[model samples]
Target: MVSIVQTGVANRASVIAAFERCGVEATRAATAGDIEAAPFLVLPGVGSFGAGMEALRAAGLVDALRVRIEAGGPTLAICLGMQLLCASSEESPGVEGLGVIDAMVEALSQPARPRFGWNRVVPEFGCEVITEGFAYYANSFGVCERPAGWACAMSALEAPFVGAMRRGAVVACQFHPELSGPWGLKLLQRWMAMGVAAC
Candidate 1:
């Protein structure tokens, strides 16, 4: 079963449906135990950074997630979930993130409006799952620089930003693969296959 962290700020239905389309069983993680013990895990979100962090903390999942990700458990973090993996986000000043990745989330510089639509993701050399493809995006903030020790993919609204970052069994995407059509489904399949191979 693929366990999805219930952050309360996520588009949970769509994410679960996406996994179902991949022929996988997806369920909400009810406790930290559910998170740590999930065979495959997904952290998905669709709201402000502070609210996401707040919900995680309120649910007592902050430490569980840290431990799980630190142990290199297979995890897929999407959209706001990706930003939550970083140290902080400009969208919610003074709110601490999971700090899994050494980076900060910043607002898109050029397009004042939230980047909402399909954008092509250009994967860096050595990216295992992500390829050059159009992925759906619906965010106002993202990581600008590639964090050290991560294989990153870039997408541009006007200036380039980190579209995805992968290290070990953890893959974080600024774009929502669940909403990206065929390319997204293929990406999900590839990621799931990678996790299964690791096991």
Candidate 2:
């Protein structure tokens, strides 16, 4: 399966290596058609809401992604990538998203701002995740009121924000799994395994 590193912080190399380590053939997205052709597409980022959205729009990938998702292609969105899957973001008011999942990307409201470092990535309903440790996080925004059947990897920030959510073939996260090491790699493998089973 091929993956697209949508943004600069896409962690494209690490993801490719991780999938390769798992015996999966992964390729970087080179064009809009590349994204559409990809059986599995990845949207990763580590920037602000406005900047991230601008990048997608400038790249002309937003609508392409929507079309692919509508067609039922598997997609994995990490960090800001996951945020872009939502309809919109209050973090960057008026900035549009792919709207694949019924959710919104909002910022953390904390007196002590600039939250960082590894945080827990456990399932919202007590289900086990790739591991029981913190995943890498650089952003302060997360998805809210996620749709049912979507697994949430929540973190303890100003509130228990939605760190990750998975629905259908689309798996999204607010953390950087590539930087999270083996456990994160395993999660990608799990997604690939899910796609294989889906086929």
User: Could you tell me the lDDT of residue 126 within candidate 1?
Assistant: 60
Model 2 regions lying over 4 Å from their true place: 111-113, 124-132
Task: Report the lDDT tens digits of candidate 2 across residue range 1-199.
Answer: 6576558665677767767777878777756888877888888776677888788788878778888776667878877788888888877888777777777766676432456788887675533444467788887667656555566766777567887776657778788777777778888877777777776
Candidate that scores best on lDDT: 1
lDDT per residue for candidate 1 within 16-82, as digits (tens), equals: 9998999999988979999989989999998899999999999999999999988888999999999
lDDT of each: 0.90, 0.73
Most accurate candidate by TM-score: 1
Point out where model 1 deviates above 4 Å: 110-112
Q: Model 2 Cα RMSD, Å?
A: 2.6
Each candidate structure's TM-score, on Cα atoms with residue i matched to residue i, is 0.96, 0.85
Q: Tell me the lDDT of model 1 at 9.
A: 49
lDDT of 1: 0.90
